[model samples]
Target: MASSSSPPEEQYGTESTDNYETTCWGCGLRVMLPSGASIFKCGWCGAITNQNKKKREQKCFGWRVLRDRCFLSSVIIFMLFVIFGGVWAVYPIVFSISLLWGIFHSIITTILSIATVSFFSLAAFRCAGTPPNILWGSYPTVGQGDLENYTFCLYCSKPKSPRAHHCRSCGKCILDMDHHCPFIGNCVGAANHYSFVCFLISAVLSTIYVSIMSVYASLHIWPSLSYSLGRLKGMTGRDLAWRLMNEILIAFLRSTLFLSSRGLLLAYLFIASVSLQIGLSVLLWQQLSFIYQGKTYLSNLSSHADNEEEKKDCQNLVRFFGFQHPVSRFFSNFRVTQKRHDT
Candidate 1:
């Protein structure tokens, strides 16, 4: 039997009332109140709740700010890599090798790479700048019987729609939130999911093009590196070791000294391009998988399975991107639009 007159601690003696059961607002999981008795942090979704106020805090200022800055810096670094590694380094080396074909291919790849980067950068910026739609109060047309369809956000003190969630980083609730991406400095939601997807696809394509060009450049460098190693076969143990070390030193210098060896510049560009390609490819694959399954990264983390209504909602999202077919979605992702939805 539950005690009514006394506090929970008093009734239970040594047992603490701070361990009270509560529901996590973020992921709808059961969680225990913290030892302090004033806050409950959800381990699943990283949501922090005020036990006394029964609300989540709006802003997270400390590490989140630093993290956001780091992400922005990463974007800058990526741009630099594309400019220096792809344009200046690899393209020049290719041009020096075969003038006509190299110039033609380099120009085409560089233009395409630049266009993709520009489009995605614009999309990411636009998505980050856009604000989320928040429902403030009850609808006049919604009868009392339909109240269960809506949920209230304790933090925002507003009515939350079916797919909406509170973003601690953004300090508000986001409608149909996919995930909060620090890399883009925004929450991926219904308003920006299209842009986010477009950015991913563009990034993937750009990286792929760079990777192919990088491989071609790398093939030219392999002969030089192989020749250096092949010269040590007839040398004795001590002489072989000394020669090997000297060859490695020369190779390192050749790769690092930009003005001296084209091989080094090509090698550097190849590694960077291939690495970016692999990373972007994996990310694109994940995004595509989520789209095909009609789920966002956040929804997946919360174990939200799609029903008929959610499937319908997903169809609406696809249509919003001006895409009716999967094949067309890739090509038309960068088409800018002013369409906005309040729901």
Candidate 2:
């Protein structure tokens, strides 16, 4: 018999008669490791497990933030510079190249920045509009034996839950108001506000980052041509003509040079700008909606938080919104119930 402390056969690469083949940790299936590898990664079951793990992690954390679209745009801009392939090395051609590059980068960066910004905005709105837990302020199904002690909310004039809040901005009860944000440009209430703000914060940061990078790229690539009104002073006719020619060349280079289809790039940029603006616009719209409805992030999360003149009405509305909201049902398991809203 082998000693109890002997290393496993696999550790010593010993020959074993027993069946020993690489297997997936997720599924009890045998699979060969890739060549020159000691471990095998399960393609199917592993993927499922990993995804489940990720989702579980998301539950623990607020949410998984996506990579910045601005960063992607930055990569694209860099790629464009690469495409030019030192054609810009020629000073004579620098004029046209620089000009064209600026126009092109500006248009593309603007578009991408907008898109990146929008993604965040959309996320914020979705979070704010449809929060996680939905608790109908409707009386909980209390039975005779139910010894659950409940508290009343001053704001909504309803039973308070563990996680409810009062939104001062909206003058109503909120479930889980993180904070009011002017950047995503909205007040994040109980619903999807986390995701919404996560998206916005990520987006705002990305846009600001990309914008700064684009500016740097501009300065590095074509510093002077982006701004030039007229001919250079104290220059002969020949010199003026040369300078004009140089400017024209830089302009063209800055505008047209790219890694792929020029037309496509332009179109994408236009779309990006429009999309970002639309997202911000949506968030802004939500601000007024909540305001008129008279609610803030904290108040919106739970209806029971606020105890004002219209506390009952507010509770009813919260119950309706919490119950009918698409995300409310989904988040029920997470204990994101409307009971959190304190009156």
Candidate 3:
């Protein structure tokens, strides 16, 4: 453990020409600092020490876990409802339309359902990346620059790497943490980040497919709507548009009164899927854009705080997906190597 010169006054001490000594957490050696300097970097091991950082009590930790569990349960239930309810309501109409079409749609639904659920489970249930264990606190074991930019995690009582962030909800430090998602009941860190992105993609696609199918099913079962043609005859420009929209709205409202149980369910599914699709599409776009900039959500926020410019490059995206270079470049290099070998 690092030792401060003055346990209480070191943090609140006044500035002076004098100097004080504090122990570095990395090398466990005393380091001298100017008076009133609350933050300093160790010259020996390059570890950063911030006197202002203090551990806070994790109040209501159980309550946070409970809240996350509740949210997770709600998400699971909603997914189940969408899957079973949509199938029950939409399948009959789809089958009635054409045998081959029904089978094709069933296959699509199976694929989307499997993909969405698998990705979701991987993202939610898997560990969200723990920081690697390293030897510290001893001068003999720790070497120069071994703990560069490292800070002591008061809660974990351990050295936290620069890339790690403490997640109160997770009760631990997560390496490359993006954010803690209540819906997933987990942190979006290095281990689960790929899964989380995949889940978002699959979810968005599933919602789009569900919305389209729901609309298609509704079209087959929708009750006839009565609209007056006289309303459009005397209208033009904005007036025409407003009048047309109003008439359609009125007709749809009136037709809904005659909708069967299946039609009503189809309408609900369509609305839900479209809403989820829009929200999830935006989230996916934001995630991809951050990846393209070689940043995670948390890192992006930190960069904004530090007024750092983002490095936007396609190579970041390629590296994130585990590619060293573009496929064309990779193949070109391979071909050149093959030619050299032949010669």
The TM-scores, one per candidate, come to 0.61, 0.29, 0.86
Best by TM-score, which number? 3
Give the whole-model CA lDDT for all candidates, comma-separated: 0.62, 0.42, 0.87
Off by over 4 Å in 2: 1-111, 123-141, 144-150, 182-185, 208-214, 217-343
**Which regions of candidate 1 deviate over 4 angstroms?**
1-53, 97-103, 127-148, 218-262, 303-321, 325-343
Name the better of 1 and 2 by TM-score.
1
How do all the candidates rank in terms of TM-score, highest first?
3, 1, 2
lDDT per residue for candidate 3 within 158-276, as digits (tens), equals 99998899999989999999999999999999999999999999999999999999998899899999999685896789989988999999999999999999999999999999999
Across 81-149, the per-residue lDDT of candidate 1 in tens digits comes to: 666666665766677788897879867776766666665566456543333343222223332223333
- Count clashing residue pairs in model 2: 61
- Can you give the lDDT of residue 140 in candidate 3? 71
What lDDT is reached at residue 44 by model 1? Answer: 35
Prediction RMSDs, each to the true structure? 12.2, 24.0, 5.4
lDDT, candidate 2, 109-227, per-residue tens: 45555564555546434434322232322123222112122223444434434445444333444455656454443445556553553454444444443434433434434424353
CA deviation > 4 Å runs, candidate 3? 1-17, 228-244, 303-310, 330-343
